[model samples]
Target chain A: MDFRINDEQRQMRETAQEFFEDREVLERARERIDGEDVVDDLWDDLSEMDYPALTVPLEHGGLGDDVLYLSLLLEEAGRVALPAPLPETLAFGAFVLDELGSDAQKEQFLPAIADGDQRLSFALYESGQESLPRDIQLAATPTDDGYRLDGTKTLVPFGEQVDTIVVAARTGSGTGMDGVSLFLVDAERVDSEPQDTLDRTRPAAKLHFDDFEIGENALLGTEGEAGPTLQKAMDRYTVATCAMTVGAASRAVEMSSDYGSQREQFDKPIGQFQAVKHRIADMWMATQAARSLTYYAAWALENDEPDAARAVSEAKLFCSEQLTQVFADDIHNHGGMGFTSEHDGHIYFKQAKAWETFLGTPTEHLDRIADSHEL
Target chain B: MDFEYTEDQERFRQELREWLRENLPDGWQAGERPGTDDPEENVEFLLDWQRTLNDGGWAGLHWPEEYGGADASLLEQVIYNQETARVDAPARINAVGIDFVGPTLMELGTDEQKERFLPKIISGEELWCQGYSEPDAGSDLASLSLSAERNGDEFLLNGQKVWTSYAHVADWCFLLTRTDDSGPKHHGITVFLVDMDQEGIQTEPIHQITDETDFNEVFFDDAVAREEHIVGEIDEGWEVAMTLSAFEHSMSDVFSIEQRWRSLVEFCQEHERDGTPLAEHTHVRRELARLHTRIQAGKLTHYRNVSKQMETGVPGPEGSMDKVFNNQTEKKLENFARRLLGANNALWTDGPDDGQWVTDLLMPYGKMIAGGTKDVQRNIIAERVLGLPKDD
Candidate 1:
């Protein structure tokens, strides 16, 4: 019944923290937000540390670590608002491939992904759609050699840069979850345009697949059977996002605390004021709770627990809603400085806003949970 | 970071479950109030239930073996709490004695004191109430004016203690009194193991919003407290009081919250709204799911606190965090239950589940105020946990 992370997990987290700090990842994130090309080098540095390979199986030329390891590393990434496709690649890309990809598909892409030579993104949600299987409207018509993809995938993270995109499209006549299938499509085959998102640190794109042709070998798992696989992948992604929120929100609270201690108005540290102090305290409490739920969800997923799906939804719901409040309170605590662009507070604030609605909003996850419990 | 129980712990849980199944009152339903609706009868029933638990060796789980306890591990204690909550078992009648007074005594009591008081506390022979808060010194406990003037081998106690839960039925009290006033308010205080059955002691029950008299105002006029009964050093009982308060706040209430949530979910499932299952309503489902997530997060927070305590051998400020979270979460759940019940929420005996939901809604108000108000807990977290400066 121990809830403490093992020594290895702790060490990995510490190393990642140190690496992120030494690299000045937050400063680079700001530069990226200002339209600088910092992601490539940052991605390379992360690759050098083999972070992208953390979740890839050893048989697939990687560390074979579980989702907990990825969550720990992503938490560090989130602290600095790392502007990379790490979550898309490791959390969604590698996980889905390993879980449902064929031996041939795993042999083809897993090693490239592990080595950081290839980038991957997921195109799950279409226009005005949440991450529900029933919301998918992309079509994959059968062809002589393969399938022709047609539809648009909105909010595809790193869509313009990733080498491959895992597309969830309808392949059969069934509705909702029955007819959905995953296809590993070449990024060049799709028309991708980067969209201006609230979280500029992590760029997203709108992908247009106009009769994009792919061979039979591009199919991931069995056709018309990607419903459960995609759902599981989305849950994993949601948990990973929760881990990131814990990091970003904790950092925001720390910053606000420091600011309150130093920035004074009444001939004393503002932190001494109960109004400010209590707000920060509340933020800290929420952040701690979010972290606990996130870690538990990651553990449940890694261990294949029976309540894994429910746990993931719970974590996502709490992290998304509570962290947004934490960030808002943090900005309020900082007063005018928090409103300035020069301050890093707004960066986390925007990140929280983006995350609050990404993958699934709090309301959406609540519905998912209610459905799972048959309530 | 594992949440799975060990084989031995699982076996312990199974044994406790079996014992409960075989021993609980026949036709007992989970969360059902035991005995009659009469408050005094309810107390008696609870006392008997505690005795039954003690006879089965299920009382005082965290106390040392020599003190008539199992000397259980922290996780086992958590399991004990969780499993008991699962069955909605009757709360121990001697909670104040076991949770606050007994631990404080074990830490600060003299050998004679421990030997004389600890066993009875565990066996429910001597129910205890804490005497820290006065009418004027509720949150500012150090400002209490209950004086204990020295008179030979005993101290003559005077003044009053307010909001002393279980005082009306308590056999003894762990009291704090100002022994000297020549120094600061926090100084010159002393903690005494005072017998409540003596003369010159009067208890007036305070009616609560829930229509229950679970606490009282205890007045002491020339009440006697033996000099040898002092639990700690004279003029330094503030720290002792703080220790007792910490024990009060360190408990995890997530299990009970989860229990209430499970029952509410069942209600939602079985009940109907306009010819449809209440659970099928979008708003009801969303609210239920939201509350369920908070409860799950609260439980994890508690486990994290226990894990931290196990590693450091000392509870941290996270206890206050859990305290605030639990209170707020329960308050929210009870509020939601009331809303769900609608007009039936106002009904007493004629309402759903005999109007238990109304009681549930009204009960958590005192909890939020007791054991340190949620605001006071926020102050603790701000100062101790966040390292924020104290307010001027």
Candidate 2:
């Protein structure tokens, strides 16, 4: 069996890279983080290319590319450290809508998503309960016709700017996984403020859904039946984030290797030393391994493998750990300048750290792997 | 890309699997080998097994059909390895000959050399060991100082070859020695197909940390190698050596690694500590999961290298990638097994699987050093693959 991507996937990857490169994505990312809430031109370009419809089925006015293609797109977004809501809008937003949204919901929202007429974000984690979404404290109380959403979701991607959000909230009595439900709510009804995250390239915000109300049609699936669907979406998100991590770590490795060749010490390039060479080698190997498993997880999700969750969790855990190590080694490869803000080292490292715990920590995923497989 | 094997490859896999099931020495999966308790008998038994493999046309899979090999495609080779590993079959006694000598000879051997040696090597009638590493040259293999002097139709060889695996049982050796000491150290070297039973050759077994004597130091004092036995041009053996080393990093034994992992998991399943099965411990479970995941990635990494090998017919720095990844994964797996087994890991024969864990734990450091030290792999990656400056 071959592990290399086919020609189409390679073309997709190259196109994504060329687009991002032409747009000066990373440079613009830095500006968007501190200066503006969004980059409209970049968003419009992505939508025009139908990037958001990648995972949606062909019947839904989308490309019907599998999770593998989506992974490649996210990977490109990561390589540039693009400060946008791509993952939120494409991976979490689009895939969840495709999988769990009824036909009417798909027709009403997917075209807007595909055309860049609307933006969507995900709100999963609550304050102090970052390890598991089972403890989602966002309450959705039953009303005459629909439900009222209250409580805060910390660390929501693009929480302040998106118009629509797919939110996870507690609907039943107990706080276990079964009581959780997902709903699409209007972002205007919530109070949002950007949080100061270590990764400034991709800004996150704290969203407070204070008594936000939505009709029954806003429920993603049957009432209180959104648990498994939410889980499926979260698993895809984990794998997608891992794809991004691989991209960032890979770029970090490339940058370090480039710098090592040009920089010199002891009358020779520092990279000539066995110490520096081996560390750089280790970084490359780690990124390769991380990338391999990330793609494997994407394949598993696309194939609907019975072990998809396990594979996704494994990928997330392994890639997170490897990416963190790669970032640290990359920094070390740069010497004193690595620690300074002048180099790109800190940017990738901070982004790596931010995504390390985006969905869950490596430890949390390890726990899931063990618990799910009953190992 | 699809991970599933094609139907034809799957059929080949089934045939190989059935053959292994029908022909493996009884109780092989229990870590039992023929004559495990007697060293001489073990050698003889392994030789017999190698010959048996030849009879079944399962030897030298990458060699040409004229040499009695199937000339299997890369995918078939991978499938064969995976199947052999699934059943934990005995390792071929002539692995050095099959994996290295035959392939290199195909690329560089004279027609006469191939006619005289390839059949015997593939048939397991003559076993070969590598005589590359020396007491002075380990990681820096090119600086090897083994000297060879031309004497009529014979070359007199003199030097010490250390860490020569299977030297004691080998009938032949592919050795490197200096034919001319006038130029750069790498130049003036020649590779010879030396008869191990020659009058001037002496092999003394060297016991490793696990107290096994698979490695040896072969002293050659005027040892005779026929002049016609040179595999490539004299003083240019470095290219031949590099080719052989590239084959070493192919990592066809990934399935063997998977087997070891399976054994470790079963061990944890059966053993208990603190009034619970070891597998029940959260820390143990976490480590197990991590090791499993890393091995999965390692296998894919191997496949990636194989895919490149298929297209290019030559290995690249990505070979070093596989080397580092496999080396680290093996070390981590063995270390985790050791820690999980605790005091029981110290047992030589009374412990689980006849005390394999102790030996397995101690054996992986050599993996890091063999074929090329981990340091050399990193250097190759940095310089050749990443285009970094050479070491000063």
TM-score for every candidate vs. truth? 0.97, 0.97
Among these predictions, the greatest DockQ belongs to: 1
The TM-score between candidate 1 and the true structure equals 0.97
DockQ numbers for every candidate?
A: 0.84, 0.80
Model 1: number of backbone collisions: 0
Instruction: Give the per-residue lDDT of model 2 (tens digit) for B95-192.
Output: 89988999899889999998889899988899999998999998888889999999998899988999999999899999999888888888988999
User: Which 10-residue span in candidate 2 chain B carries the lowest summed lDDT?
Assistant: B245-254
| lDDT tens per residue, model 1, A21-135 | 9999999989889878786788799889998888999999999998887888888888999888888898899988998888999998999988988789998878745557777
Candidate 1 Cα misplacement greater than 4 A, ranges: B30-36, B245-250
Candidate 2: segments with Cα more than 4 A from true spot: B245-253
Candidate with top lDDT is 1
lDDT of 1 by residue, B1-392 (tens): 88999999999999989998887866676546665479999999888888888899888888888898888888888888888888888878799898888989988889999989999988988899889899899878788899999999999999999999899999999898999989989999999989999888999999977777888999999999999999889999999987765542236889999999989888888889999988899999999999999999899989988888888777888888888888889999988988888777767768776766667777778778887888889999988877888877
